[model samples]
Target: MNRLTFELRLVLRSRLSAAALLLLLLLSVLAVWSGMREVQRQRQTIERLAPLHERDVAALAARYPDSKDAGNPAYYTFYNTWDPPSGAAFLALGLRDVAPYVLRIRALGLQAQLYEGETFNPEVALPGRFDYAFVLIYLAPLFTIALLHDLVSAERQSGRLRLLLAMPDAGRLWRRRVGLRYALLFACLAVPACVGAALSASGIAATIVVLAVTAACLAFWTGLSLLVATRQWRSVTNATVLMGAWAMLTLVLPALANVALIRAIPVNQGVDLMLAQRQAVHGAWEIPRAETMRRFVAGHPEWKHQADVPGRFHWKWYFAFHQVGDESVAGAARAYRDGLVARQAWTGRLGWLLPGVGAQAVLHRLAGTDLPAQLAYQDAIVAFHREIRHFYYSYLFNDRPFGSADFARRPAFVPHAAAGMPGGTELFALFLLAGAVFAAGVWRLGRLRMHGGE
Candidate 1:
């Protein structure tokens, strides 16, 4: 304990180590605060939209109060669907910054409405958000390298490494130093995250998971740093090698893999589905009304008895064609979604090899801000759209009137429940990689020579 305390004091006395630790702590706190602020802003936007949406629906109801056909209300009224952030979302904004969390959908061809673009500055989003995950994944490793790269090189350069190694229980001594430094570094990153979790109401299990991931990531970097440090090389060389490795692991490799994955797994089905649905919907205007109804009734046999088109612009026929349009592109929509899920799945598999990507996958999945979460939201919207169809079809098929009283019965959108924890395969892969690297580092350190000259 005394020796550990002395080593701790020594680290604290070093201006570089002390400054690096302080800077990391400050950056972590700042990142957490930034994430919290952004999440609060999103929540505020959702809250503010509630009344506005209500008013908008009320206005539409007033405009179509006396409509005898259900199509007027169905076609005119737009329901709002949104995906609320999970409690841990502030820690990692993920695709939420780029994707739409709130969307307006109607009882029309859902494919056309599902992919509406939002207005955002690409330049700003290009660099990604300043969040806790960014700090932990990208910046924390740099700090780790800075502190550990010179662990033995500096002592050797100062002509003290030989004397230190000559002491009794030198292996134990080095272990204490490395362990203390690792704990401090992990603490520097995890403390702010824990506080942020508390502030954001992130659950205890999630907080523990975040802390564990932090430790695992730090362990990987620390192991790599020590492996480089114990080599017969200068401190500058160690720093350069470690930094290059960092860039390759965190930035270059992931970018290349992403491009390769995209090429290998084509997801352009989204655009194809959209175009197909648009063609199906617009082409209905040119098709005979009886043909459209025939297709619609083929899928919805329950309404076959009410498939008669009495006029040129009957609501039942109009809605029937729209339904037919959606059905027309069902295969395309399924393919698009499968493509997206494939991309996400492959990315998760890649996490086994890339710690940076692995950490991101875990964090974003836990936060419910990944591609799967977005797809789940779309699924909810589809379910609610089904409800809308049922409600309107009741009035349209039976030739019942749609009035203000019926308008009040319009279904309000409810966001889907939060996705559970990240996938097990990714987490297992991360732990395996971290353990192997750390073990290698420990073994290399154990074999480290104590000579003053390389």
Candidate 2:
């Protein structure tokens, strides 16, 4: 035990180890800080919009005091719905940056509002956020390579391996050195993660999950490094190969696979739905008023009391066309949703082979910020649209007053839990892949021959 402690001191005392560890720690801290700042910015934006929305609603209510007609108020007033970031959102901002978190929708065609994306600099989003997930999945392996790629090779080159192995505790010596390096690497990575979780007030369950994932990722990196080191190649050669492998695994494969997936599953149907809704709503003007009422009454029999189209401008007719437009594209909307679900499902399956994407899938799924999570938000919007339509339709169809009092009765938007996440399967696949790689590296390490001559 004393020898092991001394070995750890020796390894950590080296300028190279100290510097590399420091750099890793610094990057991790920077990443967490950036992520938290981004989250705070989004929260502030959402909070700041509240008074604006309230004032807008108040002004419209004052302008149109006629409570009997909801049509004018619905036309002029826009209700804003925002999905605030979850407590664990900072760890992996997920699709929050690219997608619209705050959306304003009116009683007009909801299809137009549903698919409208937020204005974001694609270049900023392209590189991805510098969050804890990015650090763990992309940079952690490089640190492992830096520290362990020359573990055994350097000793052999220094004429120390033969003598060291001849000692009575040779196996113990190798374990001690490798274990010490592994622990140092773990601390350098895990400490920042702990600190970030504490500062973010992230849930205990999420923190534990993050830490376990961190350990698994480090284990994979450590095993890969020792496997390469066992080749007895030059230290420079080992580093070059490991880095090349890192690039291929982390960047190349995911990009290529994403391209292939996009090509395979085209989800441009969302745009088509929006276009169709616009056409239907505008086309209602050219058609007879009774025709629109006939169509709306077919879906909503309860509106039979107000089905009379008196050859005049009626809010009921206008709203009927709007609901019909949404119904017209319902099939296309489902197809669009299925396309996204398939994409997420396949991405989860990739976790079986690609550790980076695999772990990423797990992290975002837990945080409820993945593409599916975004879709879930969209689904919430759809449900809320139905409520908004119904709330306004009551006043329009039943001739109920929609004054300042009714504005208070307006249906509030509620976000639901993201359902049917693929984490358990993803976790299972990740461990299977990890086991396969660890086994192969173990076999290769055991078979390594040290001498130059066969």
Predicted model with the maximum TM-score? 1
Reference-based TM-score of each model: 0.96, 0.93
- Candidate 2 C-alpha lDDT tens digits along 1-454: 7897788687778788878888998989898888889989998999999899999888887888766688888887788888878767787888886888889998878887787673456687788788988999999899889888887788888887777766776656666676777788778777877887888777778777777777777777777777787786899999999998899889999989999999999786556778888888888899888888888889899998888967778887887898888877878888888998998888887777888998898888766788878877887887888888888887888787777787778878776663223357777777777666656655555453435201
Tell me the whole-model lDDT of each prediction, alpha carbons only: 0.88, 0.80
**RMSD after CA superposition, every candidate:** 1.6, 2.3
Q: Provide backbone clash counts, one per model.
A: 0, 2
By summed lDDT, which 10 consecutive residues of candidate 2 come out lowest? Answer: 445-454
Which residues of candidate 1, in runs, are more than 4 Å off?
118-121, 452-454
Off by over 4 Å in 2: 118-121, 417-422, 439-454
